[model samples]
Target: MTQEQWTAVDRYFTDLLVPPDPALDAALQTSAAAGLPPHNVSPNQGKLLLLLAQIQRARTILEIGTLGGYSTIWLARALPSDGRLITLEADPKHAEVARANIAGLSDIVDLRLGQALSTLPQIAAEGNSPFDLIFIDADKPNNPHYLAWALKLSRRGSLIIADNVVRNGAVIDQSSSDPSVLGVRRFNELLASEPRVSATAIQTVGSKGYDGFAIAIVTTDQ
Candidate 1:
């Protein structure tokens, strides 16, 4: 699709799917000021997160990346009054911006600044309380590692949403040797064949690009 067409579609989907929220608007402003890469989840994707959280009546949600809290705010907003969300970010500066954006919502959200690879293990060691919903949007090259970690922390009915799986469709081109694309391709293959979960890859166009993502739901049998 042309860029304009893509933008139109995104706007249509988001408008029909989710209404504007003050917190999300503020978070977007913070993200812009931080000069961080536009890593925040898309509005339509955020709506999807909200829907998934509600579907599972998720009490504990985990997100591996917090980009100025734009996406974190979306996910946290969906939680029940008593529900909690733990988000990890490696950049202290980014975390600071995210914290500021997410101010006044500490009762339901915890923003941890550190390498997710390290923090995830620590969190797992502390308890066996599995997450009902896990969103992975960290470094693309670590997609495989993150998936492995996410599965361990996932409950039988949990959902694991991995963003940027398509890498702008570069994943299908074997000649494309970008580490991020290669990593995503491998991760997709692994998940597609794994017996533990069922997944579907959906193409989407938005600020990210003509890219797509994978949403995997862990089966009860596994």
Candidate 2:
């Protein structure tokens, strides 16, 4: 269907299912006021993440992106009081804004400021492996690397979620030279061939336009 139709349907569904919260609203407004890219997940998607984390009964979560901490808040809410969530953001400015947005959640959410590649190793070295859930939503060009780290940081039965895989359906273009497209293609190939996990992706459309999420569960230890 048309983008207009898709957006309308998404709005209807979100309005019906996801109630407005002041903190979440402020996070979006503050991020916009700070001129951050509007790359945060939509309300419905955030709710989906919450539900997924809850469904997995995740006591520990790792998020590879922290854009103003919108999605981070949603994920963190799924945790019990003692549960932990570690989120990484490369840009200092973005991290600063996210820190403010997630002020009250400092106890449950750890906002790490650095490139994911660099910080991921630190997380591993810190004995933070075997995260119950891992969400990868950073730079698309590094998705395969993130997937590799996700495997390293997760145990069997850990849930791994990657966003923006469809890229408006550009993923099927074998001749595409765009680094993001190439990376997602490679990531999908790796997922398909990897015997350790069963994975799949579904195309989605809404306020954010055409994209999709790749979801998998670690079926075996790496």
Tell me the tens digit of each residue's lDDT in model 2 across 1-222. 899999999999999999989999999999999999999999999999999999999999999999899999999999999999999999999999999999999999999999999999999999987899999999999999999999999999999999999999999999999999999999999999988899999899999999999999999977
lDDT of 1 at 71: 79
Error of 1 at 29 (Å): 0.9
TM-score of each: 0.94, 0.99
Question: What stretches of model 1 exceed 4 Å from their correct place?
Answer: 220-222
In terms of lDDT, the poorest run of 10 residues in model 1 is 204-213
lDDT of 1 at 65: 91
Quote the lDDT for 174 in model 2: 97
TM accuracy, model 2: 0.99
By TM-score, who's the top model here?
2
Model 2 residue 25 lDDT score: 96
lDDT of each: 0.86, 0.96
* Candidate 1 lDDT tens digits, 157-187: 8999988888777889988879999889888
